[model samples]
Target: MTSDSVLARKPSGQSDGFEHHLSPTAAQALRSNPLSAKATSVLSASYADSDIRDALGLLDKRGIQNTAETRRQLRLAVQKEVIDSNGDIIREFGHVAEQLKRIGLTIASLSQGCEEMKKHISAAHQETAPVLQEASDLMKQKDQVEAKQQLLKAFNAHFIMSEEDIATLTSTAEPVDDTFFAVLARAKKIHNDCEILLGTENQQLGLEIMEQISKSLNRAFQKLYRWIQREFKSLNLENPQISSSIRRALRVLAERPSLFQNCLDFFAEAREHILSDAFYTALTGTSVGGEEDASVKPIELVAHDPLRYVGDMLAWIHSATVSEREALEVLFISEGDEIAKGIQAGRDSEPWNVDGGNDFDGLKALNELVDRDVTGVARVLRQRIGQVIQSHEETIMAYKIANLLNFYRITFSKLLGEDSVLLESLTTLEESALNQFTTLMRDHVAGLQGESQLAPPDLAPPDFLQEGFKQLTAIMKTYETSLTSADSREADFEPILTEAFDPFMEGCENIAKHLEAPARTIFSINCLLAAKNILAPFDFTSTRLSKIQDTVDKHTSTLVEYQYSFFRANSGLQPLLQALAPLSDTKEDLLSIRSLDAFRPEVLIQASQTLDDFLPLALMDAMENLKNLQSSKMARKITEEAADRFCGDFERVEEKLVASDDIWEQEADEETLASSQPLKSLFPRTSGEITVLLS
Candidate 1:
């Protein structure tokens, strides 16, 4: 066969043997025959190219034939090589089979063990199911018990208080401190919370706790009350600063209204006695401790001077009142809000203690207490001042004392309320002084009225009236600087005006009654003008000034009328004016000049000569009549007005004369009229000429 056929065909049984002994990679290669065709082509190309002949020639030259036997031998050698490779592969397969058998046995043993473990696990599960269920039930019970324990702990903490807290709140051995306040607050809260419990279905526990807390709160309040009372007893109001403990105690005790008021009452009574004694010591310069400082003279030293004595006493009282109020101010104002809240809370809890819906007012309480404290001082002051007023003979001094009392009355009205006893005492004393002054003035006036000659010789203001006005001016000065409001000053000073000024004016009027009409008018004018001068500077005297002006105007009118009458009579027109008076208002011009002898032309010419003579001296003569009047300006004004009025009368007279003359002309013949002068020449002085002459 050719090398190609030999290469393409496998050795008959060798192929089966090689396939059986092949390693996996080698067996795969043989089954696929990846190089079979290439090997065949390579063999065919080698043979065609004489490569076999060349190989045989080389073999023959080596003394070897390239025959079929040699080829058979080469095939046998290849088969042997194949057999060796097969042997090695068979050994490797044997070793692999051995390893795989050992692995299979190990896997079978593992499977049997796994089956045994599965059966054991199922048996264990069946056995422990009841125990696991028991443990779960136990855990659930433990959680529930723990939750209930926590709830019980919370209940015990909230609803119950310890004995220590109670002791701190109610026991006297423990001092009032933060702990005590905290305990008291807790107790109060517990007491209030009992109302919540009472709203529940079970009311017994609520009632028990409520009663217990109520009793505890009452004891605690009583303790605070007594402590406050003790503190007040030792309080030194002379020192402006107070202790914090006392302030806190008072704030707390305000919750019990009855106790609070009682404490205040007690405090007021004690302060009243103390302040009364202190006032006496200050006045007398003799204190229980010892004599007062020599530099600070006693008020009694000035007793002879009633005004100073009263003023000093009032000053002392005022100083004491201010100090007392300042010392106690912190007690009320510092904790005002807290005290108010406490009182309102107390009002809710203890309704029976409330009084007519009147809430606690710190300022009002302070005023009432101060008023009570000054009660004794006010009484003694009133008595002493009343004595000074009664014994004093000087009317002006009495009036001054009244003014001093009035000033103090206003001062005390601001410190203590207007309705306070101290203010009322001052008011009464002021009224007493004023009454004494009024009585003295009235008596002085009555004595003046008894005088045989009341008016001055020159019709000037009398000495008594001048002296009264001097005193009144001093009083007006005092009232001007007073604390009275501007709106009320007029009203407040009215009584003083009536007392001080009116009596003197009335005395002047009464004295004027004895003089003649002219002197009487002058005297009245002098007195009214003097009073007006004194009162004009004060705003409060406007009403009185208006009245004085009216009276002066009335008297001035009288003077004008008197001057006008003088002009008429002096100018020789009185007779003619009398004649014309019956026909002055008549509209008819039928008057007969011959029937009225004064209206005759000769009579008219004679009157015109008198008028021309009087017109030159009219104002001078009128002013001479009023020379005794106090005010020259007033005299001049009256004179000028009278002269103007006389001019009007002259015009009327001139008109009447012209009319009468015309009527005569109408009745008489032309020859009879030629015998008489013209009416214009008859009345030579015209109203214009008279007006110019007067001016």
Candidate 2:
């Protein structure tokens, strides 16, 4: 083949023989389309060189004014038949030439004015050019500043932590870097130097320094101690006795005053006391009471129970929050592009400050402040988390106490129908206890979730911020959109919930169908009630209103351009709906992000985050709502029958409940009977009237 017709192939098996490949002409065409070139060149022809008169001129002297006017003015006017009487007619005709000359001068002035307009256009464009340039420059500088700030923030977050502390902790902990170690050394030196300060009259600063050091230790020592403790504590030690080996470890700890060393000994001994359950809790707690056996007062706690319906609520909330964040990101993407587009966030000043103490420049500063809506989000989250924890704790306590009393009612059945009648009294007491417990749990969860009439209009979020503040205000609006499919779903027994499950609303009917009949009825009622009360007004106490208003106010402040109203009206609706779905059909919580399969992974993340605060409370509120539904007349009647039936079978199941080893017999054993001159203290049990069961 001729060289001109030769074909080529790459080493990796790429062949180049297709006519579809770009030729020189085609490549040139691909560089830019015809439309692009046409646009720029469209008006360029009008931008050619200007006429001479537009350049420069002497307006006063360099003019013929008007040729017709000059010629007319040079000539004299004559009138026929004006031969007598002082030539008055001749003088009138001559004045006409002078007026013509003035008209010619006016024409010249108009030409000059046109030329001046051209010069003005050029100057205007010239002035605007620099202003545009300066704006572009300022934006560029701001972008550079933003990049640097991001890098610094990233460094602090990821790098400074892990590299330095690697000597003690695992790889998963913070990546402490050289800077951290350097800082650590500095902290040590500062502490040593403070000793000298204390010796002098600088004791105030010295004391302050000491306090700061103590705080640092509190923060840092926890990690240090934990690592050492893990290392020193043996895994195989089955013995709890403080043997010689244990004493040696203790002795070494006492001699070595380092926090790490001390921790090693403490945890080593502690492992003996810590059961496998405790160890499990320490690692990943999913149970109540956790590692700390005793209750932490003024600090109610709730364990993370993966099995509870609330877990699903948490998962959903996590996903919804994540989605919200991402949507927000999309909303701000064009705006945030200012940074990547060469605009920087920096302090604006005619001259730099001594060390540039200020955060960001005018536009950049505003963007940074506004863009940190995440921080605001985080703050909201923290508050919500704290509130949710308290609410859950309160609810758990109320339920647990109720459950405990319920235990007593069933346990003391042997004496329930006896002559002593103590069991009856206990059961009555339990009924009151349960009633109170339900009330307390409901109230506490409501308060934590801010369900009750949130008060104080002043406390309410302004306009848009009320996004999450109110209970019903924040809860999901039923997707009455489901009504369109209700007829299709009515006859079929399927999950009605699946339609709401996916973002596109799929399989909801089928899922809803799977819910228990009671749950369905309760949910349907609530939904109907919710629909009827959609626009109802509430009058709440000022304090309650204020808190509810606060939740609302948070989201109100979030700026949503263009479709702001649409978003505000519908923001967080899906999450609320998901939470309420359980109340709707008693379907389990589709809580975590995994359930929202219709959305992209990133959107799921954002959704998860937004719901983070509200999910737990939403679940609690829903349960309470269900409880209320169950306590209705019909439901109560059903429950009473259930309880009666259970009591009727009490004798048949009596053997299953009694504690082994005759708890009564132990109290009345030989030791007691031998010493007894009929010992009254041990004989509290008059008979086998109320030998109770235990869990």
Candidate 3:
């Protein structure tokens, strides 16, 4: 305690001498005649006069003394105790409020189903429903609105976009980071909104909506373009992620970007209103030729593959049909402007300039929307033409696609961007596209050729998948390196190879389905000759294994010295010697040459029978030719030695076989004969006579 406490108190601790007494709170209270501001003055200035000048002075002194501790914790203050209790309540209650908000939000989501939702929202209204329900409704609205809005926002977020953007681009632009769905959602909504808001006919409204959507989309895309310009630094590029993402995102948007078009289609569901042949039927005499309802109504087109109408549509495309063309035209173009324009220009001049002669001016109106108008549209249509060239269905769809593409390329020169350095580059494509299309048609005809429904003979599944995998890998490696093609003449396929295969695949539906063994192997051999029939750039048929062997043998003919040097003068035969070194024992061949039926590459043709027949006269001619070789004196000497060895080996084999004709029938091995004989009896001639005759 301060000296003041001991002097003023009744000597609380220093008793007797000081005559002071005070506890800590009392001491603190007595320490100052006026306490700290928050502690409050211990002695109130209430002398019943309502003001004591002396007391006021003391309070002023106390305030001046404690000015430095303005925010100190007044642990001993009566009001501090009460304030602390209320702060805890406020903190706890705020936490509880946040928890309740989360719970209310969750309950609202669960309430989207009408009856269940109605109860959830209302059941608690008597207690807390009004406030919670209001909050829940706002949250629901926010959820519904945000995703759609985000989609719209993201649509324009990318650096590249659909062919639609290209159709209208004033400057070069590409879609980059935009989300596919946002553009779609907005496009559909804007289309629907335009149709509802405008008084134009359905087709006209669709056109206007498309134009507006295209324009608005271009604007939205400006945001994305800017974003991309900021973010993307390259193209076709080292930046694989950006380039690939751009292509994929644009492709998705391209797949029928007119989302509301489906709705428009739905609204115009009546037979009279529909324009597609798929939606209408025609009758020629007693036969019905077009798509018709088996009933009087429109055919029920399930969202599923439209299976019921596909066959009819197929027949339609197969035939020349206008309705099918219309559908494709709609799909391929924003409005088929160039096609219509070309057709009109062609038609108006009496020569009929392009397309089908301008019956579709409606496309022109849409063409006006973009600054570039039809460039992107024309390019997209043109690009699909090459793909159409590969399509199995050369139906009207393919034809329309091809024709429109031709018109675009032939007229616009560079509809598909700078795809080539010279305009003639695409002109070059004219022959290729036509050829591809023709080949596709030919294949299709092959597939549909016999309609022979006979079940194919069951092939025994090859027993070894492991070996098959190896062979498959090998085939892919060789084929992957070079494309098969249109060269005029290298070699012809062996006639025997393919003769066995064509019949195998006559019942097979598609050639692609037959690439595995037993088909791959059987087909490879059988189709060997048929390769000449395949449409490749190659002028000659495929070379066969035997043919390759024949060629190799022919080329190596000058190696006579080398061949015999293998016997004695082996220096120049190092390459061959090296190659054959791994095959050490020529006599221990694993193959059997007993007959042509048992022949193999590793077999030593050790018999007069093989020498007499399948040994190929060419081989003997080679041996004879080697005997007369003038290239090397050493080679000539080596050949004489080899001939002697070859002849002697033959005689030795003949003598042994005769000697043991019945011996081999008993065991896999024969004991070495103590007394060996030459082919003296078989030859019936003396060695002196043979050597003399040779010399």
Candidate 4:
């Protein structure tokens, strides 16, 4: 290879070839740059001998110069270009080395300055370390002092009550206004918060504060109680508008139950005197001031009319009760929750205030107060009403008074509870009146049971029973309009029933004993039916009416049997029945006409004649027998049922006779049977014929 090709080729395992072709510096440059080596190889390959010869030939054909001079000049130009490039590279290296020397000087100066800064920082840290630690500790102490100051401020605000608050609570000079309530509430809160303080390690502050608050609250409550008592003393129940101050004071004072109840007791005592005087004035037209008002008439003006007198007295009491309740209602009803809390506080402080196992109830308290106020009025009412009931001899009037008492009893129960003195008085008076009525009835019934008074000839109910029923009807009418609850009306009226109707019925039975069997049954039926009809209009008397109906049914059955027996004997079937009754247990052949004397042809013919005679008038006579029965429907029903039963007996007799006829026909020859009547011809009346006649 030529020298250029040898320079372009990479040195392989043979170092001699690469060393012989390139100088040491050139070979080192080629080894350092593989890309430059590959480029030289490509240039060498392009300029091969054949390519150079082709180029020389083309140049000769083109008449251009192709000589060794041009080749030598190109080689010299390449050497000169490489020398210039090396020179440029040496200049660039010199510039870079100068710049690096300047950078090293700058770095040395920076290193010396850093050492000085490190010494200064170390001295500054050593000088300021204690100062920073002291500042941090001072800040921590400042925070702790601030936190404690804040805690003290909050503690004072929560647990302390001001002198102004204490004065508002305990000073009677200050009115019990909204401000007073606010201060009282704050005091209460302070009192409650002290409990938390008591739970801590130190309880001295809590105990001291609790004692101070307790004294203040007690004084406040005493003032309120006294104020309420004074207000009640000056209160006018005639005008039903109580002042708001009194109501608010009452609600607050409920916290101290002993004081609150003492105030109520005082108020009730005052009202009792006032109402008692008012009632006496209304009754006698005599005022407490001892001057009679011309415009006000005394209820005693109507004393001759016992019902109107008693009613007027009770009416006055009821009106007074309503007015009293209305006047005082706001004191108990308004702000009930606050009042309940106050009462609970009172219970917490004073456990003995809870009485009779009853919790504090606003409405119940109002009722009890009202009852106490009316205590005097109730005593007068009971006495007067008792006198009227004892002196009244009219049975109906006495029963009416009892009803009036019962009406007032229920009215007062609604107003003042069932246990109130007013209600108890009314109940006692009512019972007394009812007993008076019962005694009157018993006396009347006893008089009716004498020998001189007997069942009427017509077998109708006696006049006394009718009169008693009329009175009973009136009593029932009064009771029906009473205020008793619907579910309880039946039981409520039972005593009245026993006193009135039962005694009348007993009188009827006693009178009935004077009559014969059928008459007695009819009389008893008439009385029972009368009682049933009188009691039928009221739904509450269903049980009593049912008992009366049962008696009527029993009596009706007896009357039916009596009428039926009358028909049987009057129709001449009694003897025949007697004979048939014996034959019923005998053999079939024994039931023949020849077996009994009563069934003989002559006897049968006589019975047939009697039956024919009676069948035509059976129902009319039976109806006439029970004509005295008060219920015409019942009379007709009894007549029909009895007639029907009589027809049934006749049908049985006809059946027996017909059956005997068949035996007679079989037993007798035609001559004997023809001479003696056939059983059918003897008893010619069939049950159908009898039934038709009765109908």
Candidate 5:
């Protein structure tokens, strides 16, 4: 190769000739010259003559090997060895189309099976739908029916009454026993159940049930009452055992208090019936079974023995009523409890529902029974009292009146504290009895005062006044026991004091005035002293006794002074004046026995002896009278006053006698002395007598 061809060629390491060859145009374009010797040389080296001829034979524009040039090329001898690759690919595509047709047929079969299954599921749902819906509805109804049945069973077990129990209770032939109580217990339980179960849900049903229960109990109780009345109609209520058994039964029955109240009401009615009969019997003056004929009388004749029938009636009534009342106490029929029940019932709008404490109906019945018995007995007593006072006005003894007053006082004192119409009646009776006693005393006093003027003062005190004083003292003694008791207040004594003092003291004054003044003084003083002794034992704080004492004292001091003045004038001077009067009356001083005294010598001696003995004897008699007096204080005063007056008067008289003797002695002459000899001789004996008397 020429250098130009060698230079135009790509570098030797650029590409392998088979995997990467340049196109002829690219090769030709990369070649620099067409006629260059380097190109010619490269062509000759790559293609031998045989290779050139074969490459010219292989060339065709459409790769076909024949032409005019193809004939030529054919003649040139083309090599013939051929392989068919497109025929095998066409066979494989035919097999794949057959497999695709088989898969499409399998999918069509699956879609047809799915449609059949869906139609079967729809048919099954249609067949089961009604059954399931009916089952759900039945279950709901079954639950409701079972719940209702259970409710009915519970109500019957707790609240319903048995036929046998009801029949036994309703049957009047059956005796009251535990069965009755069992019935009541069941009834109460049912009532409580109703409250718990139906209190708010069904109030009207609860009320109806309670009403039915109440009626049933009432019917049972009525039957029991009838049975009791028939069986025990003649039972002795006074018998302790029977009464106790009955009371015990009542208390047991009272456990069911609502039902028991009806029974108690029945008992009260029975008691009232018996009480009415008894009261009627007593009113008609009819004796009971065992009482004597003489033991009772009509009320008008009660004064004959007022305490007999009246006292018996009172005692019997008290015993009967008190026994019944005690039984009621066991049944809770107290006044306090009943009053509280009334208050509670009034406060609550639903009064029937409250406990109310006690049975108001039973209490009312009991109260009526008590009031009837008490009122009936009190009426009889008052009537008897009135009759006695009216019938025995003139004949009743003072002591009997006193005893009647005392009886009334004691009997009514127990009742005075009670606040009832019965107590009011008792109070009226008491006041009436007191008035009767007062009237009797007033009448007696008037009679005494009227008769006082007829009594002669020359005698002792009038008989009426004496008897009155005696009566007063006896009354004081009788009433002392009453006065000390708490029931007899100070006011009770006022009437007695008023009655006694005024008339008796007036009588005393009249007796005193009728006497001579000196004797009157002593007599009045003694009478007053005797009165003081009689009155000293009593309390007369507001009475006329004090006034009597004042009158007595007043007369006493006057008497003392009067006696003193009399003694002062007459004590030693009277006889001396008589002795001097005869001597002064004679022509000459006679000085004889007749002239010496008021009479002969023997009379003078008697007169002088009498005068000498009088003072001591009088003083001794006064002291003896003082010794007999009950009060030494009064006696002492009398003794002191009388003695002082007598002593002073005698002393003054003695002084006058002595001064007269001195006058006679100083005036005497010879003839006068001869005349005075007899007088002077008499003077020493007279003076001696006076001295001896004084001693």
Candidate 6:
């Protein structure tokens, strides 16, 4: 090849290949060859100008044409330069060659096989075109015929489908969409129109048609219910489609004379399905009638049962009944009628038999299945409640008692009217609970009249009684809402308050009858007063208004007499006055004695003896009796009387001493002075024990 052609064929310097080791002769030949310069010039474009120029400068400095040894060295250098520049490209080329050898043959076979398969598939499509086209045309025609038949079925009244027939047709209908919705609507309308048209002309024919539709709807729901009972543990009754279906069925049946009976059956059956055992347990944590045992009564259980359980049950029934009632009202009954308002029960609304002239209850043999209204359910609850109260009796607590009454009250307000017997039942329950509480009060106070000693002034009945009062107070608040009479509020609380006050009165009576000694009678009366004071906040006075005044008057009189007698027995004043005889022959002068020699030693000895007899005993007795006194006023009064009497005696003795001192001073007599000193020494200071005792 020419030099330029060879350079282009192989990469610039790669035209001449390297060996494992370069021979000296080959290196000498490469150094003198003009191709090296040509190759370097060609590779100049691939490298930076500085690198190429430096390499060329080193070549020039070493001399291009040198000795054979130097030239060999130059040739070795050129060989290294060429190899380093092309090393990556050479290694990559070798790796690509190895990979191609390993997998290229298999890939070629795959590509050829794919091409062949594509050809065969195209040929198969061409072969089946006519047959597929014919099948498509046939399906289109069948669909058209089926659509026409559905349209005919939708409009034709005579084409009434049985439950089984509809089930078969629904399977063929496959996916339910707008078409099926339209079909159902049209079918519903056709049935309605036919019944109306026939009834206008031939009443018997219309009745037959109506009965047939009713049976069909009932049968359809019955089958659906059976399947659901078998298949599902729960169903979503809130689903709009399910609700719509029920309502539509109700409307169809309601237009006929048999509206009430049919709705009643449907409602009862639907409720039965919805109110499963699992559902009940999930809601109430107990079975339908609620948990009961001989030892543990349902009344207590009812108290503990969460209010939400009743509220939820009531809510579900109310919602279902209201929905069904609304649908029925759209067809048969006027909005204002008793039946529409659910005031007239379904069982009562049944028509009289033409043959017997006797009315039939709507459910016939299945009357128990039908719940007449929420009121009827509440009535059942009331019945159970009565049993509970009868069985539980005294075992029920005050809050529980109030709660039972409140449950009835709140429940009646939801579903019952003023005229409902359930409301009367509620009143009866309230009266029963109140009476029970009254009985409890009577039992609590029954022994009060037999008590030997009065209760301490601050002593109350018990915590239970207070709790009972609180519960009763709460119950009264509920009563005000339920009873709605001003007099009723008064009547209710007055009786309860009266019962509560009886205990205190009995305690008072026991005090009077049992305590006979003067001191104990005084003490007993004091205790009664303390109890009255304790209960002052409760307005017991008002409750006992007629009798309290008389009670107070009698007790007050007894109190005064006993206190006066007590003072006389304990007083030292009597003896002191007796000893200090009328010094100037007048009763008023008795207190005016002011001389040391005014009286005989017998008078002094008698006064001293009177004080010695009474003062210590009186002071010690006062100390001992301090706790028994009713009030601080009574104790202080006793102390003051003693202090006044003793101080007066001391003052008189001091006056006598001072007068004697004046006589001694005038006479300057030792005998007078000696008598005065002895007299002065004989009288004790008034400020000492008297002051301490008074204070």
* Predicted structure with the largest TM-score when compared to the true one: 1
lDDT of 3 by residue, 1-695 (tens): 22233236442343331213446676666556444422232222223343554544544564533333532533345377679999999999999999999999988877666777678767767778678789999999999899999876763443224566443332334344443335545554664555553565566745655686667655554433343333322322222233444333322322222322232232223211222322233211111344335544322232122222332332332232223223323433433344344334434434433333336444332222211222232243234334435543442233233333344343333222333222333344445554554454345435544553322233222212222223223322322233223341232112212321233333332442554432333222223222222313222323533453453233233243344443222211123223333432233321111222212112322222333342234234434444422223533454456546534533444343334333323323434332322222222333343334333
How many residue pairs clash in each candidate at the backbone level?
A: 0, 81, 40, 0, 2, 3
Reference-based TM-score of each model: 0.77, 0.13, 0.18, 0.75, 0.52, 0.37
Pairs in clash, predicted candidate 6: 594-656, 595-656, 596-656
If both were scored by TM-score, which would come out higher, candidate 4 or candidate 6? 4
Return whichever of 2 and 6 wins on lDDT: 6
Assess the local accuracy of residue 415 in candidate 5 as a C-alpha lDDT between 0 and 100. 33
- CA lDDT, candidate 5, residue 433: 55
Worst 10 residues of 3 by lDDT: 590-599
What TM-score would candidate 5 get against the native? 0.52
In the range 15-132, model 5's lDDT, one tens digit per residue, is 3232127577666654666654364455434332587546544553335533366556553443332224566677899999999999889989998998999999999989999999
> Candidate 6 — what's its lDDT?
0.49
In model 5, where is the ten-residue run with the lowest total lDDT? 676-685
Which portions of model 3 show Cα errors greater than 4 Å?
1-407, 410-526, 532-676, 679-695
Q: Where is the poorest 10-residue window by lDDT in model 2?
A: 497-506
Q: Considering lDDT, which of the candidate structures 2 and 4 is the better prediction for this target?
A: 4
What global local distance difference test value does model 4 have? 0.81
| Candidate 5 whole-model C-alpha lDDT, 0 to 1 | 0.56
Candidate 6 vs. true structure, TM-score = 0.37
Candidate with the larger TM-score of 2 and 4: 4
Model 2 deviation from the true structure expressed as Cα RMSD, one decimal place: 47.7
